[model samples]
Target: MSLEDLYREVILDHYRSPRNKGHLDSPDFRAEGVNPLCGDEITIDLAFDGDQVSQVAISGQGCSISQSSASMMSEAIKGKTKGEIEDLTKRFRDMMSLDGEADIGLDPDRPGAVLGDLESLQGVRKYPVRIKCASLGWNVLLEALDGEPLT
Candidate 1:
């Protein structure tokens, strides 16, 4: 299958069977995000240990991009330090900003440049409108770090 097709399958898989799709009873940080344009909403709950994310859970309702992005992001941030998560978040935003170029640092062969399954969503950049859908969860994650009240 083509790379794009593979990416589509990955996204679909995440959407159909999301990871960390639940709530944390007592989370250290929590934030919710909504994309009014598309009506996508997500809540992120994080538990941290001395500046490291020990666990992450996401609850939301939205399109495949938003849901799958939340699932993928939850998996990525778990067990990561605050600094690492911040860097990864920046990298992900940079990836979303790509305008059809292969500069998101994704290289299947190289492997090192790949952002795991998160890179699969790179195609979302092609649809400018969908960018917000993909970024909803990520933006909430940042807000949680900033101690903003989630609505």
Candidate 2:
């Protein structure tokens, strides 16, 4: 299959069968994010075992991009350490931003390897408004991890 096809499949699969798409009994951290223009809202809960995130979950209503991004975020960070999560967030943000001048230290190829088919969403930059939808989960995750509001 082609790269675009692979990326589309990754996104569609997440949208169709999201991971961590519900509430947890108790959470180590929680954050809520909303994009008023698109009416997408995400509530993220994280459970940490020491510095490692033991569990992660999300509950919300959103467009396909927002919901699927949340699912991918949950799957990506569940067993990672805070530092690793932060790094991944930065890489993902940089990848999505597509700011030619941005100095994201890591070679996009290595991390993009893990991003797998989801990398196709990099084209999301072409749709300015949809950017927020794609970033909903990322911002929420950062806020929850930092114990602060995202805005």
The candidate maximizing TM-score is: 1
TM-score per candidate: 0.87, 0.82
Name the regions of candidate 2 deviating beyond 4 angstroms: 1-7, 98-114, 148-151
* Candidate 2 lDDT, 1-151, residue by residue in tens: 4446424767878888889888878888898999878779999988888878887888998777888888988888878998998888877788677345234443465745656544656767667677777888899888898894222
- Please give the lDDT score at residue 127 for candidate 1: 78
lDDT of each: 0.84, 0.77
What would the per-residue lDDT of candidate 1 be over residues 15-96, giving only the tens digit for each residue?
9999998999888889888888778899989888777898899998999999999999999998899889988988888888
Candidate 1: where are CA atoms >4 Å away? 1-7, 98-102, 110-113, 148-151
**Alpha carbon lDDT at 146, candidate 2:** 88
Provide the lDDT at 140 for model 2.
85
